[model samples]
Target: MKILIKMKSSLKDIVELIIQEFKTIASSYSILLVLIGGIFIYGLLYNYMYQPNVIRNAPVVVVDKSNSKLSREYTRLIDAAPQVEVYGTAVDFIAAKELMKENKVAGIIYIPKDFDTRVNRGEESIFITYAVTQAFLYYSSIQEASAGAMLELDDRYRPNMVVFLPAKDVLQIAAATPISVSGTPLYNYTEGYGTYLIPAVIMIIIFQTLMMVISMISGKERESGSIRHFAEQGTTLKRVSRIIISKTFVYCILYSIFGLFLAGLIPIIFQLPNIGNSYEIIMLFIPYLLATCFFGLAGSVFFTDSEAPILMIAFFSVGLVFLSGISYPLELMPWYWQATHFIIPAAPGTLAFVKVNSMGASMADIQTEYITLWIQCAVYFILACLAYQYNIKKAIK
Candidate 1:
């Protein structure tokens, strides 16, 4: 009879906590912003910005001082490349620089008068390329297009000279002169920035938005002296677990709907490849959401004001994106940052989602991240309990 009564009391406490959480959410415009605006509204806007996905036909001016057939051929090939367009020919370097200064062109390609002579002499022909500093994509397009055109020209023209060499040495000469390369891009075939960036950014939004909302609520509780009222509920671990579980349940349900939009609907709407099985994506999210919520709750113990967490956590947004190791190579990161990656839920979560969604990875492939998120879930759950226990003690005093 006594054990049953305790179970009943816990159930009643959980229901009351859920009800209070809903009431708090309903009353606060900021919380509404975190739940709705952060997900649906901002989500669409971000997708729209990355709609182009790939950069193409970035303009450049070519300075062809070579005036030889080779330079002209190089120019023709460069103009034909998908990444860049040769907007205009420049009479001199001065003219090319002017165009770049005016922003009329993203880059300048200069083929010196001696370029053909150097190539025919079996010497490396140096072509000067100047790209504007404004956008790295503009520079990338110019460099890629120029380099590709040069390689194609070298392969086609150099082979004719190899015909004159001894038959046995001919193979060696042709192979040695122009090294042939065949590129096979994996995962992102189109090399679209949208494919690479959007997946990771969406996950960060899920994390940061949840943290801010939870932290803001904690800050409000601290300010309102409600931390003291938590003491009245009792200091038992059972009571703390009830409060934590109920709060986590509310956010999980709300975010699950948001996660579906982020993982399922938004991808379809934006035409991001939804290669992963639906069940797998949903399963990955369970630990991710739980970890994020508990981590937020644990970290919120430091907030003394409602606005402090918004200011503090919001600053970490860009850092968190970098930490995802999408834009930057994870292997290149310092040891400490790499160690920190395992501690944070989103680092592995973002990479795992991308592998599954974009790379068509199996459950076994993402097992490392799957396990890491659960580890985080366990660690943060304990931390949140400890934080709440501390709050309860503070309240009693």
Candidate 2:
């Protein structure tokens, strides 16, 4: 009977603590900004900025020194390509450089005077292309369009080289090649910068904001000495466990709504890839949220003031994104970074979400990441309990 009464008291304490956390978050303006404005506003702004997805008709200046029918035809073909438009012709390389300096074009294409001569003689012909270093997409677009134009030019001229042969043999010679190469971009059909990046960014935003909020709340409790009130409730292991549970429960419920808006609605509004089974994405998200929440709770012990978390945790935003392996592949990373992937929730969570959501991978495909997240959850949850126990002890002193 006495044990049952203690159990009832602990349950009541957990409920009260949960309600207190809600009231505290509602009352704190900084917490409100990080919770609502940080996630919703930032998510919308990022998607809006990248909404264009693919760059098209990027302008390039051509230096056509050959001034022949063949060179003119090549120039026309380059302009017709969807990736780039020929803004104008420059008489020489020097003139093209001036246009590039003026930012009049994203790239320059240089066709040498021997361009037509080499083609006519059935010799290898090469043209130079220069793209500004401002953006890789500019260079990629220019390169793709130029290479495509060159292939078309090759087909048009190959028959001319075999003019003396019999018609059937000539046709075969023009068509024959050592090998054929075709490239098809999977998942991201357009190969847009936005499509490739935004999905991962969304997951990072969730991890970061949740971490900041938890740290701030923890810091506030310590700084204001409100932790004493919590400590006074009880210093038993059971009480500390209940306190951690209550805090985690409050954060999870709050972020579940936020997660829906972020993972669900934002992708639809921005037309980002959302092909993953919704249920599986949620299942993946569960461990990720728990891992991040408990990870935040554990780390909050280090924060001495509410403002400290904002200052310190904010610096990690870029680092966390890099660690997620979206910006770079995990296989090529050094052994230590690969190992670090296991410790950080965002890393596996981001990769798994990308595979499931963007690549349409099944739960089976993400088993490694799914398992890693649960491991982090288990590890961090224990750490959070220990951290709160320390805080409660300090408050009692």
Candidate 3:
């Protein structure tokens, strides 16, 4: 009977704290800014910037030292490729290099003076191509254009001299090439960077915004000595549990709306891949939001001032994006980094969200990530309680 009464009292305290927390959040303009502007407004802007995800017709300068029909043909074919354009012709290698240095071109195709002579003499010839490595996309476009032109030339020059052989042997020889290969970019059919990147980035934004806002609120409470007010109301566990529950409730409710906007509405607006089942996407967020809430609460212990979390955590956005394994393969990462893959909610959350939303994966396909998020929820919830308990004691002193 006494335990039941205590439970009821705790529930009542938590309810009261939830209302108080909402009022506090509404009053603070910064928290509202993060919850609204950072999550939705910034999300829209980032998606817009990446809307035309694939770069096409990147400019390149051609150095035609050969000045022969064969060299001119190769240049024309390269220019015809969708990925690159022959923006200008350079008289010398030095002029081509200057064009690249001046940002006039992303790549250079140099055909040596001996190119035609070597081809005419039935000797193997090499075409030297240089692409700016500053951006991988630039390099990729240049390589694709160069390879396409070379392949076309090879098909044209391939001798049809199989007449001496028997009919079957002739056919086999005619059909044979030095090598054959095909590449398919699955899931991301359009091969658009926005399609590949925006979904993962949206989840990371949710995680970052929640942490920054919650940590800032915690810092304000600590700095203003309001933590002691909660401590005075009950035992340490009661105070900590109530605080965690209250804060978590507010953020979870608020961020669920943001999450829906990010994972659902924005994708529709931008025509990004939104193939995931709506219910499955909603189910995925249950653990994701909880884990983020608890992690933010536990980490808020380090914030002495509201500005501290902003300054310290803001720079970690790029690191979080990399850690999510969107930019790199998880298999190639070291053991410690792989461990971090499970530890950080964003890593697993981003991967799972992409699988379901972009790749049309079912709940079973994301079982590992779903379970990992639940584990994070449990672990971080305990840590949050402990951190808040310690904060309460510190405030009392």
Candidate 4:
């Protein structure tokens, strides 16, 4: 009977708390919420906003002074680079520089008049281009295209054979060949950076948005004597856990459908490949969503001021996103940093998302990743529980 009364009272407090939070939020106009929500969602979608990595059709101006077949071939090779959309060739250096300065093109390549003569005479040549850091990706792709052009020449002109030196001294024939390389870029396959970026950003947005909403509301209740009333009377860890579970359930459905619709429907409509399992993506998200919610809850339960949740949530947003491999690749990171990346829930989440969606990785291939996600989820849940207590109510008051 006593336990039942405790449960009933806790339920009442929860209802009151939710209603109070709703009132506070509702004070903002609907248009404001819509605007805020749009900004919030957009932020979640475009973490590296204002300028994203949509490098396709990037502008490149070619200054072809050579007019010869070889230079034309080189110009064609530059045109073929998917990262750059070739603009009309510049008549002179002044025009090329003007185009670059006006932001009409990201870069310009100057193909000197001696281009073919130099190649035919077995002489080295130079190509000059300019790029700002923002245009670095396009610049990188151009360099790769230049390499491919070199390889094209080498393959067409050079032949391998055993050069016999007049007698028994069968020395390998050497032209003192100049070393050359070709670096062809494999594009993002999905045709846009958003495909890769959106997947990870969606997860990040969820973590940040929910962290802000839940923590502020949770913290406010604590500071306003509500947590004390609930704490001194009726509260259980199980009830608190249930509330979190319910909210996550709601948001998970909302976001999962929203994310998948964009990821799936948009790609299919545009003939782009989503190539990922909805089930696996959802499963992968389980650990991350749970971790984020409880992480906020733990902070709210511990902090004396309402602002702590906001600060802590923001700090977490930056750190966690940086570590998630959404911005930087895991393979490129230092070995120890890779290990650090693995420890976070987002690492496994994003990896699994990309594997299942982008790479079409089989479940068997990602079994270890699946297991790791569950382990991390459990670890985070344990930490949140251990760090959080029902008595947080009395201490703040």
For model 1, what is the C-alpha lDDT against the true structure? 0.85
TM-scores of all predicted structures: 0.76, 0.76, 0.77, 0.63
> Where does the lowest 10-residue lDDT sum fall in candidate 2?
157-166
What are the lDDT figures for the candidates, one per model?
0.85, 0.89, 0.86, 0.61
Give me the runs in candidate 2 sitting further than 4 Å from their true place: 58-78, 87-180
Per-residue lDDT for 227-334 in model 4, tens only? 554445334566555445544454454555555554555445433436777776666666666655656565565655556655665556556656766577767988
lDDT per residue as tens, model 1, 158-184: 766664467989767646754567885
Candidate 1, pairs of clashing residues: none
**After superposing candidate 3, which stretches have Cα over 4 Å from the reference?**
1-8, 55-74, 84-177
Better of 1 and 4 by TM-score: 1
Displacement of residue 113 (Cα, Å) in model 1 is 15
lDDT of 2 by residue, 1-397 (tens): 9999988998998999999999999999999999878898988877876776776998999999899999899999999999999999998899999999999998999999999999888788889899886665677789889999999999887767785467898768667776777886888888898889889989999998998999899999889888888777677767888988899899989889989998999989988899999999999989999999889989867977899788877788778778888888888999999999889899999999999999999999999999999999999988998898898688668
Model 1 misplacement above 4 A? 58-77, 86-177, 325-334
The residue pairs that clash in candidate 2, if any, are none
Clashes of each: 0, 0, 0, 1
What TM-score does candidate 4 get on C-alpha atoms?
0.63
